[model samples]
Target: MKLVIIDYGAGNIKSIQFAFNRLGYEAILSKNPEEIKTADKVIFPGVGEASSAMKMLKESGLDTLIPTLKQPVLGICLGMQLMCLHTEEGDTKGLGIFQTKVKRFSQNVKVPQMGWNVIKELKSDLFKGIKENEYMYLVHSYYAEHCDETIAATDYEINYASALQHENFYGTQFHPEKSGNEGAKILQNFLTL
Candidate 1:
């Protein structure tokens, strides 16, 4: 199956590419709308600030294209935050694929919740072979709040949505590409879908 990784210039494209490579699939990194539209599956991975990332997507016209995708689309980390309606990071508006909102973590624990954290209350085929409370790698100062689309939840300083699903759209607040074996399983699940 053809897989396209949306390269809006804000994602960790190489690591994502490598992860898919390990899964025995060659994923193309492209900013072209035509290529993205025709792919069987799409990955929207990002590792940057929300506002700047949104700027890039808008400039590439992907901001408009992404929300209308009929194929299964997976958004990772900052990419997931951008799928929400809005983000507190710079008061930015997102692609609105999900009705939730992203907000900065309270100062109670730490600014960015780094390292491994277990994701619980798993839902969707995205966690088919994955078990509940499986550790996923995460590094973010902001999180998508629990909403109707929330498929999995995690707790750090506060309880938040770790993963979300709205029809064909799937998003993970953690980096499945960086989560090792379990991460690979998640990506494979997306591919099989």
Candidate 2:
């Protein structure tokens, strides 16, 4: 199956690539519109700030193409954040696929909640075989508010939307490629979808 990882020059892409390799699937990293449009599964991975990443997407014309994708599209971390309507970070607008808003964690909790965290309230086939409250690696400050599209929820400062699914589009605030065994299962499940 053709798996394409969107490479707009804003992510920790190598690890994601290696993760897929270990899973015995080749994830092609491409900014090309045609290559992405034809893929059976598309992985949108990002690891940087919002506005600039959106800029890169615009430069590649992916900003327009991504939302129109007919196949399953998975957004990771910043990729997921950008899939929302808007983010408080950089005061930027997002792709508007998910009807939610990204907000910064309060000053009470630490910024960039790094390390392992449990994701519960699973609601999609994406978590198929993945047990509830399973630990997944995460590193982000902004989170999408709970909405009708939320499939999984995680709590740091508050219970917020950690995973979201809107029809063919799926997103995870945590990095499945970095989350060990459970993470791998999630990626594998996505491929089956």
Q: What is the C-alpha lDDT of each candidate?
A: 0.94, 0.96
lDDT tens per residue, model 2, 8-117: 99978999999999999998999999999999999999998999999999988999999999999999999999999999989999999999999999999998899999
Relative to the true structure, candidate 1 reaches a TM of 0.99
Q: Which ten residues in a row have the lowest lDDT in candidate 2?
A: 11-20
| TM-score: model 2 vs. ground truth | 0.99
lDDT of 1 by residue, 1-193 (tens): 9999999888568999999999999999999999999999999999988899999999989999999999999999999999999999989999999999998988788878999999999989999989999999999999999998999999987789999999999999999999999999999999988
Q: Which residue segments of model 1 deviate by more than 4 Å?
A: none
Per-candidate TM-score against the hidden true structure: 0.99, 0.99
Largest lDDT belongs to which candidate? Answer: 2
Clashes of each: 0, 0
